[model samples]
Target chain A: MNIRVADDLTHAVGCIDVTHVSISLGEEAEAFEAVSDLSFAVTPGEFVCILGPSGCGKSTLLGAVAGHLKIGGGQLTVDGKPVLGPSPDRGIVFQQHTLFPWKRVRDNVAFGPKMRGVGKQERRRAADQILQLVGLSGFEHFYPSQLSGGMQQRVEIARVLINRPRVLLMDEPFGALDAQTRNMMQEVLLDIWTEIPTTTVFVTHDIDEALFLADRIVVMSARPGRIVEDLRLPFARPRVSDLVTDVEFVRLKRHVRGLLRQPEKAPQLARLDPLGVQEA
Target chain B: MKVIRCLIRGCSVLSCVALWQLASSLHANLGVITFRNVPPPTEVVESALALLKSPKLLAHVGSSLWRVFAGYGAAAVAGVAFGFAIGRSRAAGDLLLPPLELLRPIPAVAWIPLSILIFPSSELSMIFITFIGALFPIILNTIHGVANVDRRLVASARSLGGTSTAILFEVVLPAAAPSIVTGLAIGMGTSWFCLVTAEMISGQFGIGYYTWEAYTLQNYADIIVGMLIIGVLGMGSSWLLTTFGQALMPWRRAVETR
Candidate 1:
């Protein structure tokens, strides 16, 4: 399947507009604002990373955008339509272990089209193509539990990408990996993004990660999270692993670090999952 | 190491049998328990061999097997269906769980009288008792499994464009499988236990009935043979269930080996 045609690229979709969006997590009596009036716009095909301290609702914002969590106030829209619930148009990748353990790599990747009633052979073919793109061509029959952490994440990405999602929402997708694997995955992700060119919103706390992968970084304050800065990167496309050591990259990292180090009014809240506070 | 372990286990069982044989052969009488009327191991073995040669053995074994299968099959279907409904939907839980919870604690033996009254035939009553015996473990375990399914997996499935039905079949069902299989295995054991109890009380042609008949006839060796048969059947069925479960969830093996 042609993931993205030249004609479709000219009339690009996947523009995300978050206008004064506020989200409250937990039960009504115990509810607290996770994201407070977070406003940002990601233009079609732009790679935006939400960079923040832990529990700052960076992942929560991504959750709301992906339609897994509800927006309590204001509007969160993708491609000019309200995200009422999850759809194939918006595919999300959690940090780790979200891959279906029972499914083989190919079946897991093919789940999207299978849900869409795509024929078995066609979806498998599509899955293989996407798996190859994510550098997991030979391991299609391996169960998710059989694969390494990095390989599993690659399968996770391939699973999402098989839908040819209009927007890719990643919540610290490489956070669970070791340093070496994380860097390699960053390059691999960039390669896939280059080929697909979907509107991507990645959430990460690592400054170097945000600097290297994102076209624009939306930094936020802790607790009742709101945008502190929306810094644009000057780094060129197809960024190499060596870009993290570049002087400009280091300078931007320091600036972002300073923004995150500001004293919090409230104490650090427990880390909220992308699916919001789980009901006990 | 494995061979030695197996040998030790074999010796342990053999020693137990030897002890029993000595006690029964000598008519050993402890204060609380006595082997005065018990049959020796050799006599029990002879009785088992005689039963194997008799045509009545097939009729007894076949009836018990068929009853257990029918009751356990029904329990499996209903338990899983009820479990999925209760686990996934609050409305279903609120509506269905109260009566089930009330019935869950009542032992299958306790249901013998009521089941006999409720069903039109003794055969149906025996199956109902077996169903009751197996139902709780399967349902409770299924509920636990489905409820404990990682919310992230469901959220990801939904985000990937899976409909409610697709998510249930593709994601939730498979994720809950290992626990369900565990429940099924436990259920199989319980079903056999209940079937034997029901058979003894009401059956005309079952291994349980034969055991009861032997007790009435004072044929001590045949009673021991009947008990051994019941033990073997329970063990065999549980083994079958576990094997079936492992085949269903090949991923669990991968995780364990890794």
Candidate 2:
């Protein structure tokens, strides 16, 4: 399907192709501005992490890239086309169990293509492929509530990945997991990224997670959030915990901690104006 | 294990009846309230068996069943359709629900006089009264059920490209099925209670009419038999509906999906 040209908002004057985009939701509130003109981009097949504290509009920015939120004041485009709304080209896995409870796990995975009116056999084949990829092949007939939280989220990932989007948007997909499960999920994610090498942007609060999975880590200040620093992955692909002990990884981790300690709000105009603050 | 449970249940029920019969026998000579207006256990059994042999009695039972089913079916279909329209559309619900609520509280029997004047025949009036009895419950429950389906699911469906018809059929209807069944069961039970009053007042050939006909003839035994039959039929229909719902809602029970 053709990506329709959408009505331009205030953010739409001139911009290049955007890979990783940022957004703010504080304008909805009366007092504090939740997010600011926070922006970044990743090259094709790049893995990026967005790390911030509890309420840093992390999910909001993910939504902006998913074409789910309005661009407030910054333009975000992928492949030279503006995102009017969510598409099969961009798959998202929410933190919560967004699986349709009425649908079985396999059907949930099949939903994206089924909605696109794909034939039954093709969608089923794709769904089964992703289910195996996520290690949920035997769970095709199970409902969302029947599975454990971690298993449910795996189904969520399988559902999103079935369509093979150009970008994968995950908002703390593993935060709800237990520590052991979270580590396992990271390993699984790294493996999938290695296999597909799709453009993946993951939002999280864990400093180590941001360090471990990302090809580049983008740390943001609190409210009126801005990209404070962008740290490249010093480690190699299919990352393991061994890198957590690496000297470069330890140094990058400390720098991110230092940036988060600063208050959420600073000067929004000066932060991103005239060669914006590259590091907080 | 299930068969054993059923066997235990049957024995328990029989044991209770046997105990009741023994106690009544002990008091029968004393003649206080010992199975006087209340038929003794043996008499109830005999009444059922005797009625089974009688064409006139069985016909009354069949007619009463017919009246309840026909009235309840019409009311359920009309009520559910209107309920869905009103419940799914807030403005329509607001516009229609008030008048229905206002009319709901008025006894179906009170409408008997109005129904007679309005309809061409007493059967039509009886159907109207039974419909009145069943309609509000069906509509109210269906409205609640449809309205209360998970909004997130609906939103997700829209995002995933479900047409309005698909959304309604596949999502809203299944989500609301349990509540709708509950309404139908309750409504079916209550329809009998209402049908009796209609049959007594204006019905020519129903169990309720026969009960009154026996009362006028001073055949109190037949009156009691008719009452007992009415009670049994109502219970039987309701149990049938309950079983049907349980069958349809098996997955719901397992996963708590609704």
Candidate 3:
């Protein structure tokens, strides 16, 4: 895959325009294409969820967008600039809480600004503010190991948000938490997003989570992942947990599940036995 | 439970001492055992008390400590530095590790002859032996630690716009610290062993020298005192190393407690 930016193409003002992006992994001579011609656009302040079954390469796609992984083909641009490598302009949260185990919660949150050469006093204050925003007000001096899994995730979220990134890429940030904790984290995420909305591309395997959190759900096909459907969710903001019982939520879940259940779309998935990609 | 555990430990130590003292007394009276050289706890204590008054005891301790710290401190810094290079860089590992691996299996005691020839003084040779003993474990553990750092953590740091230097300082070093500390603790034990061995074989001063002198003089009680000093010192240094390691990593302590 190759990326070529033509002179005539205009930047979409404030958006993540992923144009036929593909990613390949493994050796040079026999590289396996994991994602293929996945095209989509995320408008400014839009919350988009990329949902797929395991081995679908949704995380790879997100990794490419975050500039953590190199795109093998096509162009991926954020607000017009091509994503060649990682920048503070885009922040990512992983399934595992990636806060530095050595750092205190406040220091972990302050890391991005610290890297960008922010002064000690200023970064600490900014970190405290973000920590408070993530509802971890009293956990400033606590190390990651002392906190529960849910609290660690909160620290991870605060770490990313403190950067004030234009695009927030989350690969199942709450996936490792318990069911109850996952629910609480989702609400907390929504509250934070409402307060300071950024263009978000959240990748997950959970259909209910996708439906609940996304402005648009981008469902991907299996191996050699491509876009299967891009359904717009019309759920109003300030959505409550009670909305899960709404008929529309269940209908959307069933539709996405049906799309995921089709085995014919990716026959190569069967060959991946014992080596299944951990999507969530 | 804690008090009971401590009491059990105290009793275990006392029992061993009591058994040794009884055997010594019985052997002295009946001549049942051929182990005449074995000093009783009383004799050892008396010898230790007598030795404590001699100024040479302080000199021996001071010299041994100086050599051990000089050699071990140098080894620790050099080992960690080389370990990071070999672990993180393929070129460095390929170029340097094979030779190190070949040299590592050779025991520190075996290097005494060559070290004596290479260095100007036996003092340096003794320190060299201690250095060799400490270096291998520290380097090997550090290499393992740095190489095994979680890829996800590095990736996350890179995504957060971390430079290579920043990532190394902030993520890789800290993540590898637990393993490095384990190596350091192991290295400290090995350092003491090699130091004593080297001192016994060829040394003008040290605890090992004092012990060797006592053996030549047929002062079995003084020999026992020397042995006990070495044992206590070895145990104490290792404990200090572990405590230092724990202080550096607050997260590991929390997890351990949990």
Candidate 4:
């Protein structure tokens, strides 16, 4: 399988800059701020995880970068270009595998290229190649409904990656999987990232998931989310499952947990979807 | 267990027929109803066999089948097209829905007089009534299906670089297919109902015309035969539609069986 590699010298392509961004959910009259005056920057090919409690608006922040949700204040830019609307250059993988149920796995993966007007044979070849990268080569002919949850998310990742996105945005992509499958997926994701080396911004409530996957973890506060801590991991590349037991890893996890803990007096906020307000 | 279930089903039908045979032979009458004028299963079978051997049987069945196909085919195309338009666009819905909603409540029987005037010939009028019978169910169901398509799927398709036209065809259409098929199956039944009613009123040859002709000629057994034939045709067509729908959606079967 042939995979395209990013040029070593052109470090400017996938850079993301978020400055004093705020987002609100629901109608104008009743709307509440989900993320308030947050700022972050990601260098090209860096894997950054947005770690937050439930309803902390981390996913909402990812949505702004993906150009799916509108920002109420401040600016978001990719490679010096202001974010506008959803673009294939920034691929997103939702927590639920948003694979087209009607399409076979091969077609689902091929969809991005097909939309770009690639011919049937060529796009299908690309789909097959990418499917192999995600360890789903043999399951091409199966429909999404036929695949297990882990396999479905694998296909979802492949579908997004086939676009060769400059920035891969994942909103808890393995959050729905069983603990065993989630662990395996986290490793599989790292392997894929090793191969393609795309800039990644992953959102998750799971502390271990954030610690395992990210080069840097941006921990966020509860609703009306503000950045509480930005921690850089010292652990070396090609991370293994056993790294979680490492003393440094455990210490950082504890520190991140403490950062995530909210004040007892603060009221719990209902979860907001990346797409803005949750429908009644 | 499967064989026993089949046997029980078969016996149930046989017993119903046996009861019908006993009632008709005895000329059973109650205050509100009578089986004296009704034809027995044995007489209906004989009449059905005689009609099957007659040359006119082909003409009657063929005309009915042709009218149904022509009217139903048109309804399916128009309904789905209109459904997609209305479901996707608020402007299209506002423009198209009011007149359709107004027209929907009028039964095919009520349309017979207006259609007879609107169409140049009786054949066209009967077909129009059949078209009317099918159109509303197909259109309404299609709209319902399209409107209910998961927003996430649409959002995903757009994020994947699908244009509006591509998204509508690839994502919205397939997502709403199961609902559209249900509409089509229901529409087929109503098409038969409307066609038969229209044919009885003015048709020269059709199953409905034959049934009405039999009543006027006092051939009550032939009426029962015509009714049975109509029932069988309706059942066969609905079965074909559902089977075709299932074949088109292989993914749905995998989900359902799982």
Backbone atom clashes (below 3 Å) for every candidate? 0, 2, 0, 0
Query: How accurate locally, in lDDT, is each candidate?
Result: 0.89, 0.76, 0.86, 0.91
Interface RMSD of 4: 3.1
DockQ metric for all predictions? 0.70, 0.21, 0.55, 0.60
Docking class of 3: medium
Give the per-residue lDDT of model 4 (tens digit) for B94-201. 999999999888887899999899999999999988988999999999999999998888888878888889998899999999999999999999999999999999
Name the weakest run of 10 consecutive residues (lDDT summed) in model 3 chain A.
A270-279
lDDT tens digits, residue span B132-174, model 3: 9999999999999999998778877877778999999999999
Model 4, stretches more than 4 Å misplaced?
A1-12
**Residue B129 lDDT in candidate 2:** 87
By the lDDT metric, which is better: model 1 or model 2?
A: 1
**Rank order by lDDT, top first?**
4, 1, 3, 2
How far residue B42's Cα lies from its native spot in candidate 4, in Å, is 2.2
Docking quality of model 1: it rates as: medium
Which candidate number maximizes DockQ? 1
TM-score per model for chain B alone?
0.96, 0.84, 0.94, 0.96
Candidate 4 positional error at B6, Å: 2.3
Instruction: Look at candidate 2 and tell me the lDDT of residue B186.
Output: 83
Q: Rank candidates, DockQ, best first.
A: 1, 4, 3, 2
Q: How would you class the docking of model 4? A: medium
- For residues A116-216, what per-residue lDDT tens digits would candidate 3 score against the true structure? 88899999999999898989999998888889999998899888878778788888888888999999999999999988777788989899899999999
